[model samples]
Target: MSKSIHKPGFVLGDALDIPTFKVLKQDGTLYKGAQEPEFDKEMALKLYDDLVFIRVLDERMVGAQRQGRIPFYLASLGEEAASVGSAGALKPQDMIFAQYREQGALRHRGFTVDQFMDQCFSNDRDLGKGRQMPIHYGSKALNYNTISSPLGTQIPQAAGYAYGQKLDGLDACTICYFGEGAASEGDFHAGLNMAAVLKCPTIFLCRNNGYAISTPSAEQFSGDGVASRGIGYGIATLRVDGNDLLAVYAATAAARAYALEHNAPVLIEAMSYRLGAHSTSDDPTGYRSKDEEAQWAKKDPILRYKHWLTQKDWWSDEQEKTLYAEHRANILAAMKAAEKRPVPTIDHLITDVYDEPTPHLRQQLKQLKAHMRKYPEQYPKTSGRLDA
Candidate 1:
C-alpha cells in the first residue's frame, strides 16, 4: 500500500486566539464570573506575608548592591505573585527548576532569610559553597534545583528530571521557570517536544515580563505569545495575569492536577512586567520611562493581595507595618552575619567533582596556591585557609 498524501484545508486567519486568564482586579476584587480557588484565610494571609517579605528583601538587596555589599542581584519586584502563588499550589515533593527570579518560590518552600544572605555573600555557610553568583540559589531539602546562569538550560533538564520521576513511579512533577526571553532558545522547543513525546509530568512556567533585559516583547516575537506555542507542541497551555495572586494560584493548581493525572506536560505563560531593572548591572532608565514604571507600580501584587486580605478582615495596616519592620531588621542582620563569615576553603575548590582530584586539577590548584602565596598582600583576609 502506498502512503496517501493528504493536505487538510486550512486558513491563515483562522488561528486560535489565546485568552489571558485573570481573577483579581487592580483593587483586589474578583471579577464577576471569577471562581475563587481553595484558598482560606490562613493561607491567604501567609501568601500575603511572603509577598511583602520578598518585596522588602528585593528592595534591601538592591540597595545593598548599590552600596557594594553584594556583587549582583535580581529582584522579583513586580512579579511576586507569579512565583509565590504557583509555588504555593505545588506539593513539597515536587521539584523546582528555577531561573534566578523565583526566589519567592524558595522562600515559600521554607528557604530562610539567612540562607539567602549566605548564598548572596558566597560564604562558607552557603550550600553552593561559593560557587554560584549572588541570587543563584538551591536547596536539596526544598527540592529546588540550583540555578544556572545560562538561559533556557533548565527547560530540557526539567523534562529529563520529570522522566526520571515517572520511571521511579513517583507522584511528583517538575516545574521549570524561565523568562520570555528564554523561549527564544532552542532548548525551549526541545524540552517541550521531549515532554510531549515521553508524556513527562512537567510544567514550563514562562514569565513573559514585557522586556528581556532591555529588549521589549514587541521586538522579541511576532506570534501571540509564548502560550500560543504550546498548541504547536500538543501541550496543555495557559496564559495568566502574573500579578493576580488568586488567578495564578487557581491556574497553577489546575495545571498541576492535569499534568499529574494525565502524565503530560503543561505550559503557563505568565503575563507580567518587571517593575525594576533586569539586575543590579543594568539601569532601567536606559530603556524604560519613569511614567511607564509608575503605571505598573499601581498594579503592585503585594499591595493588591494586601487589599484582598484587609477586605476579608484577615490583615490590618498595623500588621503590614510590623511585618515590614521585622523583615527589614532580619535581612539587615543576616547580611551582616553573612558578610563576616569566611569564604569557602581553598581545598573545596578541588572537591565535589570526583572522589579524588584529577592530576591536572591538582597541578592547577598547586600553581594557584603558589601564585596566591606570591601575592598574599593583595589577597583579602577571608581568602581561604590554605594550611587547613
Candidate 2:
C-alpha cells in the first residue's frame, strides 16, 4: 500500500539539513521567539552550581594530570551544557548510560567531589575498587551504568535495558550519551533499530562536539549531522545548540516526555565544540587552530548561564567569585585526600565477579601475589598487601 515514483530515484541524504534549536543567545538573552523551560529557582541554582563545580573540577583535575597526580583525564571544557543541562531535565529515577565526558551528568545526580577524586585517583574509597581509569564513573545508587572503555557499547545496552524497563511497567526511561564519533559505530545502528522496533522508551543523546579524539566531524561523516542518522532509524530527532543551557534542557525535557508517553525512542544531537584537547594526552594545537578554539570559547555555556542568572537577580559577581574560590579549594583538598588514600587491596581483583571467589580466581590471585613477591619493585607495595 505504498505509492512509488514513476522514475528510479533516491533521496539525497546530503540535501537534508536539520535546524539547530536554540533558546538563549550568547549574551544570555532569549531569542525573539524562544521560550525558557519550566525551571524553578532552586533547580536552576542547583544546575548552575553543578556547571561551576564540573568546570572547576575539570580545571583542577587537568592540572593534577599535568602534575602527575592522576594517570589521565578528560575535560568537558566547552560542552558543559550538553551533559549538565540534559541531565537537569531528567528525573532522578531514570537510568543513565553515559560516555566518559558526561561527568556533569553524574554531578547532577549528587556524585560528590570526593567521589570524583577517589575514582580519578583510583583510591580504596573508589566505588569501582580502583579498576576503572580516570573519568570512568558509575553509581548503582544513581542508576548510572559503569562506563566501559569500548566506544558505542552503551548504545545497544541502553536499548535492551530500556526494553526491560518497559516490560516492568516502570515510569522511567533510559538516557544514553555518546559522541558523534561513536555514532559511526555499528552499535549505534543496532541500538537505534532495536529501540525503534521494540518501542522502547529510550533517549539517545549525542554530543556532536566536532571531533572524536583529533578526527574532525568533516572527516567522520558526510550527512547533515548525527540527527539525520537518527531520522533514518525511524526515531524522533532534535538538534540543539549544545552551548545553550536553556536550549539543551528544554529539548531534553521534551524528548524524555515524548519517549515515555509514546513508549518510543528519541535522539538528541547537541552541536558543540571540544574546546580543550580531547584528553590530557592530546594536543589540539596540532589538529585545530587557536582562532577556532577562541571562537567557541566566547560561547562558554557556564558564562552564558551565569549571565542569565545574574539578569534574574539570582546570582551576583560576589557569589560567582566566592563560588569559584570555594570550589577550587574543595576540589584541591579532595584531590590531595584521594592521593594519600591507599589503593584497593590485591583481593579486590578476585572479588565482585561472583558470590565468592571461584577456585580458578583464587589460584590466579595466588599466582599474582607470588609474581608480585618475585618483583616487589615492579608493583606498589601497598597494592600487593593482602589479608593473610
Candidate 3:
C-alpha cells in the first residue's frame, strides 16, 4: 500500500495540525458548537470544591514551606482543572499513578485535609511512613499508588498494572499522570509501546503545562507536542484545552471509554501553563516574565469554572469567600495537629520491609539508634522514638 514515490522526499512533522478541544471559553460560555459535559449539580459542585481546596492548600503549604515549617512543596496552581477534570471522569475502581502535582485528583478521590497535612508533616499518621518527601502522596484504599520521586517511573508501572487488570478481567483501567518533561524519558516510550502492543487498557494523561521546571516546551521537544507522539506509537490521542474543565472532562471520559472498549491505550495532551514555580525552592522570576504570568492568569481554570457555576446559579461570590475561609481554617487546624504529633518510631523504618526483620537490617537499625543516642544534640529528638 505504499505510495511508491521514486523521488527523494521528506514530510514535515508539523503537517498534522492537532486542534485543541475546548468547551468553555475564557468568558465562561461554551463555544458555539461545543456540547456541554454530562455534569450534574453534585458533580459540578464537587469539582469546584476540590479546585478551591487545592488552590488554598497550595497557597498555605507554600507559605508553610517558606516559613521552614515544611521542607518543600509543589503547587498545581494554574493547572488545577487538568487533574480535577480528568479524575472526575474516572470510576473509583480505576487506579491512578500521579507525578506529584495531581493532588487535586487525590483530593477529589476522598483524601482528607488531615491526611494531606499528615503526609506533608511526615507525622506518624502519614501513610508513607515519612519515607517520601512532601507532596508524594498515596493511598491503598483509594487505589492510588504511592508517588515515587524519580520521574517517569510510574508510566511503565501503570502499563504493567493495566496488563494485570486485563488478565484479571477486571472492569477497570489504569490512568497515569505525568508532565510533558516526563514524556522525554525512555519509560514513556516503553510504557506506551507496551500498552499498545499488549492491548492494555490505560490512559496516559500528559499535562503539557509549557515548562518542565523552567525548561520550556519549545526546548523540550520539536514535534507538534506530546499528542503527536501518541500517533507515532499507534495510540489514540487527543489534545484539549487544560484550562477548560468541561473540555478536560469530556476528553478524559471519552478516552476512558475508548480504552476500555477496545482494550487499548489512549494519550491525552492537556495544554495548560504552570503558573507557579517548580517548587518552593525555585523562583519563577529568574526564568519567566510577570507579563506572561499575567496573561495566563486571565485564563485561570478555577475562575472560569466559577463563572460558569455563577451563571448556573450554583455558586455566588459569597459562597466563594466562605469556601476559602472554611478551607483555610480547616487546613491550618490540620497542619497544627499533624505537626504536634510525633514522627514514626525508628523501628518503623525496618518493620514493613519484610515479614520478619533480617539480622543485618536489625543491626543497621540498632546502629542507627545508637548513633542518634550518642549524638542527641545533633539529631532532632522528635525525628523518631530513639529510646525505643
lDDT of each: 0.91, 0.93, 0.94
Model 3: how far residue 360 lies from native, Å: 1.5
Of the two candidates 1 and 3, the one with more favorable lDDT, higher being better, is 3
lDDT of 3 by residue, 1-388 (tens): 7688888998789987989999998878889999989889999999999999999999999999999999999999999999999999999999999998999999999999999999999988999888878999999999899998889999999999999999999899999999999999999999999999999999999999999888999999999999999999999999999999999999999999998999999999999999999999888898899999999999999999998999889999898999999999999999999999888777888987999999999999889888888888887844448754
TM-score of decoy 2:
0.98
TM-score of 1: 0.96
Q: How would you encode candidate 1's per-residue C-alpha lDDT over 312-377 as one tens digit per residue?
A: 888888998899999999999999999999988777788888999999999988898888888888
List all candidate RMSDs to the true structure.
2.4, 1.2, 1.2
Measured on C-alpha atoms, candidate 1 has an lDDT of: 0.91
Q: Give lDDT tens digits, candidate 2, residues 1-388.
A: 7788899888898766789999999888899999989989999999999999999999999999999888899999999999999999999989999999899999999999999999998888999998889999999999999998899999999999999999999999999999999999999999999999999999999999999999999999988989998888889999999999999999999999999999999999999999999999999899999999998899899999988998899999899999999999999899889999888887888778999999999999989888888777788645446653
- Which of the predicted structures, 1 or 2, would earn the higher lDDT when compared with the native? 2
Error of 2 at 91 (Å): 0.7
* Better structure of 1 and 3 per TM-score: 3
Report residue 315 deviation for candidate 3 (angstroms). Answer: 1.0
Select the stronger candidate by lDDT from 2 and 3: 3
